[model samples]
Target: MKSTGDSKETFWKEYEKLPDAIKEALFSEENFKIVSDICEANGITSDESKSKLMKYVGKTLMGKLPIKDFFVTLELEMDMETNKAKAISREIDRKIFSGLRIALNKIYSTNIAENKIVSDNKRNKDGTEIPMPSKNEYKDPYKEPLI
Candidate 1:
């Protein structure tokens, strides 16, 4: 009965507008090495793999795991020397940043889209479902019959 704009999009967009520092630390030099090395070693270097890794890191961030602990887990998969990983981190910083940024954007976008779609379902004030009329019915089931 009321319409103006999509609130879910606005909420996520507001979150995206925050300073990079405040954003979830989904991007780290250590994370990049862990992911890139594994993907390369498995001959699976691809955007899709990066996306999966991003989701993994994003989950860790959302879980509020300390940054240091996150790298420890990542190293289990990567195993690059600390010094080498740190240096390699700088070299691939741009790619790592871009991948993370894209990953977060996709995560937020899908989350908002799914929520908006779920919210579109019509429900009673008491949250009871109303049965719908069949196609043979004269009136639209989704709408109340006209007076």
Candidate 2:
């Protein structure tokens, strides 16, 4: 089995290869709700407390914000003391990050499967198989159905 660091590296590699549309989907409002539900079920944060965290997380995932900024924002937005904000950040990272990684992997795997299917169906004029596109080639976005 891969170590946590190895798996995380692999995850980010795959994440970087995803189309922008799919990357956007990973941090969509629907996914935020899913993460919120997961966190709420685990008693880490109340519904009222999640919005700020979720927004920061989304920004972080999109590469638009730093996590340190998230901690500060969490403290200010939720009116928590500094230590409380740090504790909540740790809890959120522990509880929510794993689930988000799993969701991203699922999305990435589905995209690979779909791309393979599309590539497999393609053939030359002489009916010979053509190679799959390079990593930079992005097809249409595939939307996963919400459960």
Candidate 3:
């Protein structure tokens, strides 16, 4: 929700200028705000932000998809470098999003753990027990499972 830039074009343009290897490695990373915020916070030059984003995106992909499937699909669709590049770029998008969601989940868990510790000692307005966060770990533990 942070104001990352004046417009979205700046975001995509920043993304495109990255080296082909980096662009390819991003695995379709799309936490636009996360990328923009990191860039802004770290004072990374545009080029550096691009490279860092690609690296993080790679970190994202290392968990969700098979490297072999990624390349095989790229080759299956491509008769040319540009086409292969575009195809691979699109392919990684899904993984980038998946990775972002995974990160959010982890953050949610940590917050839950924090909450649980605070809530466990309190009671409902009706004077009922606030059960200890079902999970004995982390903040925000009393929050119901979002699933």
For each candidate in the order shown, give its overall lDDT on alpha carbons: 0.52, 0.63, 0.47
Q: Backbone clashes per model, in order?
A: 0, 0, 16
- Model 2 residue 32 distance off true place after TM-score fit, in angstroms: 4.2
lDDT of 1 by residue, 67-116 (tens): 33544444454564565444433433344445455544554565557566
Give the alpha carbon lDDT tens digit for every residue of 1-147 in model 3. Answer: 345654456656644544454345454344554545444544444865446445544533333233334444334432325454344445445434444554434434544575665444568899887765555565685878788
**Candidate 3 similarity to native, TM-score:** 0.22
Q: For model 1, what is the alpha-carbon lDDT of residue 111?
A: 52
Ten residues in a row with the worst lDDT in model 3?
59-68
For model 3, the stretches where C-alpha displacement exceeds 4 angstroms are 1-29, 64-147
TM-score of each: 0.27, 0.38, 0.22
- Per-residue lDDT over 24-131 for candidate 2, one digit per residue giving the tens place of the 0 to 100 score: 655676667665765575454776567666766765554444444767877787677787677667765665555456554555466557666434446889989877
- Cα lDDT of model 3 overall? 0.47
C-alpha lDDT of residue 125 in model 2: 100
**Evaluated with lDDT, which candidate comes out highest?**
2
List of clashing residue pairs for candidate 2: none
Count clashing pairs, candidate 2: 0
